[model samples]
Target chain A: MRSHPHHHPAPDLLLAYAAGSLNEGASLLVATHLALCPHCRAEVTRLEEIGGALLEGTEQVAVGDDLLAGVLARLDEPARPLIRMPDVTPRPPPAGMPLLPQPLRSYIGGDLDRVRWRLTIPGLHEAAVPCRGGSVKMMRIRAGMGMPRHTHNGDELTLVLAGGFSDADGHYLRGDFAATDPSIDHRPVADADGDCICIAFTDAPLRLTGRFLRWLNPILRT
Target chain B: MADTTEVDRLNGLLLCVARQRDRQAFVALFNHFAPRLKSFLLRGGMDAGAAEETIQDVMVTVWRRAGDFDPSLAAASTWIFAIARNRRIDRLRRDRRPAFDPDDPALVPDPVDGAMEMMLVEERAALLHRAIRELPAEQAELLRMAYFEDKAHSAIAQERHLPLGTVKSRLRLALARLRKAMSGDTLGEQA
Candidate 1:
C-alpha cells in the first residue's frame, strides 16, 4: 500500500480500527488509509484475529433460552425512523475555496448555504454541518482561536480544513489529522492568527470543564 | 463454542435490526455491550451516572449507524469496542480530561516484559487473550498489570512493594518470554 507519509492514523485509532469502533466518516478515512498503508492494515488484521481469539476465550454470558426468539421478535416488530442514514456526500466549500481532501469532499456535496452559523469563540465559530445521520456539526477555529484545551467521552477525529494547530505531539495543518487515544491527555491550541476549520464527528454531547463553564456548555450546544 | 456461534448469529441479527431501524435490536445491542462499555469507562475513571449516560449515547449511535458495519473487516464485538473507545475519548476531550501517554518512559512497555502482556492477552475481549492464557500464572499476572492497567515498571514495583531493579528484571524477562510465545517458541525449549 502507498503511504501518504504526511498522514498517519493515531495509535489509538489503529487499536480502534483493530477493534472496529470508528464511526463512518472517520472509519472511511482510516479505511482509505488502510487501503494505502499495508503495514497499518496488517496490524489491523492481526488485531482482529487477536480480538477474535480473546472473544473465544471469554466465559460465555448465559442468555435466556428465549434470547434468539426475543431478538427475532424484536426484528419482526415494526421499524422506526429514529435512525436515518445520511446521504454520504460532501458539502461545498465557500466560494473560491481550494479543493478539499477526498474524505472531506465526500461529505460536502456542493452545499454551503444551509450550514447554520452557531457561535464563535475567540478564534473559532461552531456551525451545524447538516446531515441525515443524526446531529453532526462543523467547527471552524480561526487561525488563532483553534480550540481550548479539552478531552472527550468517545472517539473524535478532528480533520483540518485550512490552517493548523499544535499540541504536544507537533503541528497539525490542513489535511493533517489527530486521533486521541482514550488514555492519553492533550492540549491543542490553534494557530497564532489564521483559522483552522475542523469537521468534528461525535456520537455524544461535549462535556465542558468547571462549574461555570459546564453550565455554559448547554448554551453553546447548537 | 455454541455460544460463540450464537453470538455471531446474534450479531448478524443485530446488523439486520440496525439496518431496518429496529428499536428492540438497538436496545438489545445496547443492553449487551452497555455494561461492558461502562466498565471500560469506569476503569478509565468516570463516575457511575456519567458512565451510564455514555453507554446510552453510544447505543444511540449503534441504533443510528447499524448500516455502517462491514462484516468483512471486523466482528460485532470488535466494532462495538471501537465505537466505545472513540466515544470515551471524545467525551474526555470535551471535558478537558487529561490523556495518558503510552510513550512516557514511565509508560513504556518493557521489551522483555511478557508476564503482564501475557495475562492481558488472556483477558476476554482482548484480541490476544488466548495467546496469553497459555502462559504460567506468574508471567500472566505481571503482563496483566503492565498492559491492561497501563502501569509503568515503577508503578508495578510500588504496587508489589518490590525493589525497582527486581521489577525491571521481571518485566524484561516477561517481555522476552512474550516475544518467544508470540513467535510460537516454548519457554522450555528456550531454557
Candidate 2:
C-alpha cells in the first residue's frame, strides 16, 4: 500500500503492459510508476498469472525437434554472459537526483546532473537516450518556463521525472504520466517552485503549430 | 483442483532444478513449457525458427536462473510465462523488430509479491483457469488474441472488423469479470 500518483495510466494501457505490448518509453514510465504504486503492480501480477494459466492449459503443439540437445550443448560449451539483463542490485542515483526512480537509474546511468543535457532553447533543454523502438528524450524546463502550443502527429507519452508541470489539463507531479494523441493540443508550463524534468517519447514527430518555434522542432527530439 | 497432481509436479520440477540443477528436472520443465512458450511467441507474431530459437534460449535461461525461482511466490507456469515474456522482449531488441519496445507501462521485475495471500497457490491458479474457461466464447476468443496473439486491442478490432470502442469495452468487461473471480474485487481503482 504505497501512496500512488493521483492519476494512473488507463486500464487498457495497463493490460498492454501486462501483455508486454506497450512501447518502451511508456513502459519505462509505467515501470517507474508501478514501483511507486503497489496496487497496480498487484493487478499486473494477477493478469500475468492469468496469462500463465492460459499458457498452461493451451494446446501443447510441441516443437518438431528436440531443443534440449542444443541447449545442453551450449551449457557444455562455456558460461557466457546473457544478452544483457542488468544485475538485480542497481547502483544508487548520484547526489541531487534522489527523485529519479528505479530502472531509469539503470538506463540513464544516473540522475539529472549526471546526464549530459543539451539546450534546445532558452530554459528548455533535452537529451536523447539510446533506445530501440521510439525517440526517448529527457526534457528539462526551468522554473516558470513554458512551451509553444503544439499537437502531436502520433502518440506522445511524457512522464514527469522531477518537479511539476501544468498544462491545459492540470498540474502533473513526479511519477505522473501524460499521454497525448494526435487530436489533442495544449501548451505546458513548468511550475514556479523548481525545474520540471520529464522523460518523453513519441512514435512520430510532433506537429508544432506556432511557426517561430517550428524551426526549433529539429532540436525537440519528441 | 482437477490438475492438483500436475500442479505439484510442476512445482517439484522447479524445486529440483533450483536445488540440484537436476537435468531430469530441466527435461520435464522444457518438455512442458517449451512447446507452450513457442505457441505464445508464435501468437506474438514470430516465425517458427525465431520461436524455436527463443524457447531454447528461454529453457537455457531457466536452467541458469532457476535459483531465482521461488515457488512460494507464484505458480511454475506464472514464472515461466514471465521468463518467456522477458525472452521475447530480448529477441525483439536484438532483432530490431517493430514490436520489441521494452518501454511499456508494465512494471519490470514484477516479482509477484507474496503479500497478497490470494488464497493457496493451486486454488488461486484454479480460480484463474476456471474464470478464463467461463468467459463468453466471443470474449474468450478476444482474450486469446490479446494475450496469446500479442495483438493490441486496436489490432484485434481491425483484424476482426469490429469497432475499436466495442473491442475496448468488451475487453474491459472481460478483465473486470476475471478480476472479480480471482481476487474478490475488480482490482486497481481510480483515485
Candidate 3:
C-alpha cells in the first residue's frame, strides 16, 4: 500500500461514513480507506450498527391520507436505462505499465466500449459510471499533464487508481485516497511518464483559477 | 413514544419509500428531520430564513438521494445531521471569499434562540440515551460536554481542571465504553 505521512481520514468523514451521509462516489472513496484502515473500519461498522439500531427503534407518525397513493403512483414509473456515452480509449499501456488496481478494474474495465468519457481537459478526462445509488465517475490524467490550479467549493475526495500525482502535500499513488477540505488549494501534477486515474466526488463545482481557463469554469461540471 | 422495534421496522418501510419513491416515507422523513436540521444550521450562525432554506434543500436532497442511505451504516437522524452539516459548510465556504458588510441588515440578523423539540420518532434514541446514562458518571459527563456544549478538548480540560492528555485519554476511553455498551458488549476491560 502506498503511504503518505499525513494521510489520515478526518473524524468527520468517518462519522459521515458511519452515518451514510456521503454520496455514492464519496462513499466508495471512504470504503476504500476503511478497507485499508481496519481500526477506522471497525469504528465505522460499530457506528453504523448503532445507527441501524437507533433507526429501528424510531416511532412512526401518522401519515397524511394521500401520501401512500402518491408513492404508489411514482413506484409504477418505469426505470430509466443506463445512458451510454461516446467512448475514448487511452493509448494501450506502454509495453510494461503496471496493471490497474483491482478496485478500479470494475470501473475502468477491460473493454473501452464499457467506459464513458465525459469531458477532456488538457491532462484529464472524466466519465460517469452507473452504480447502485447514483452515477459515479473517474477522471484520468495523462502523465506529465497536471490539472490546472483550482480550489474546491466544497469537500472533494479523490482516490488514485493508477500511476501517481504529487501536490504541495505529498505523493499519492494507487490505492491512496486523499480528502481535501475547502481551505486547501493546490495543483496536482501527474507523474512524468505514467498516467494517473482517480475517482472523485464534489457537491459544488470546482473553481479553476488558471488565467486562460477561468472562463471555462461555467462549463466544467465536477 | 416510538418503540425501538417499531423504528427498525420503519427502515424497511423507508427502504420501500426510498426505492419505490414512496412520497409518504419522504414526507415522514422530512417532517422528522427538517426542523432539527434547521436548528442545527441556526447554531452555525445562519439566519432563520437561510436555515429554513437550507433545510428545504437538505430534505430535497434526502428525497433524491435516499437510495444512497445504507441502513447498515447509520441511523436516520445521524445521517440527516451529516447532510445538514455538509450543506452548511458548503454555504459558509461559498461566502468566505466575499467581504462581510456589517451594515447590511440582512447579513447581521440575530441568531435564532429556539431549541428544536426532541420528539424523537425513533425509539432507539431512548435506548441510546439510556445507554449513555448508564455509563460511568465521568465518562457520561465528558460525552455530554463534547456533544452538548460543543467544546474542544483543551477547553473541556481547562474547565474540568484536568491535564490536557488526561482529558483526551478520558474522552477516548469514554467513547470506547459507550461503544461497547451500545453494542451490547459487557465491559470486559477498561482502556
- What would you estimate as the lDDT of candidate 2? 0.75
Question: Where does the lowest 10-residue lDDT sum fall in candidate 2 chain A?
Answer: A88-97
lDDT of 2 by residue, B4-89 (tens): 56777898899899899898888888888878887889888899989989887888778887898887778889888877876777
What shift in Å separates residue A216 of candidate 3 from its native position after superposition? 3.6
Ranked by lDDT, top first? 2, 3, 1
Evaluate model 2: give its TM-score: 0.84
Q: How would the docking of model 2 be graded? A: acceptable
Identify the runs in model 3 with alpha carbons over 4 angstroms from their true place.
A1-8, A35-39, A52-113, A130-135, B1-131, B134-191
Better of 2 and 3 by DockQ: 2
Q: Name the weakest run of 10 consecutive residues (lDDT summed) in model 3 chain A.
A: A79-88
Provide the clashing-pair count of each candidate structure. 65, 6, 11
Q: How do the residues A1-222 of candidate 3 rate in per-residue lDDT, one tens digit apiece?
A: 423223646554554445433444555566654444435545664554444333323333333454334434444345431122213244343233334322333345532344576656666788875433333567788898878888888768777756879999888876566767578888899988688877776756778877887877876763
Q: Give i-RMS (Å) per prediction.
A: 11.9, 5.5, 16.1
How well is each residue in A1-222 modelled by candidate 1, as lDDT tens digits? 111325567554554444433334455555434433444554564455444444333343333344334444444435553322234553434455333433334345433344455565555667764432234466777655535445565555665555667888787765556665344446677787676666665544455654345555665554
Which residue segments of model 1 deviate by more than 4 Å?
Answer: A1-36, A48-222, B1-7, B95-129, B135-191
**Each prediction's DockQ?**
0.07, 0.36, 0.05
Q: For residue A110, give model 1's deviation from the true position in Å.
A: 16
RMSD of 2: 5.2
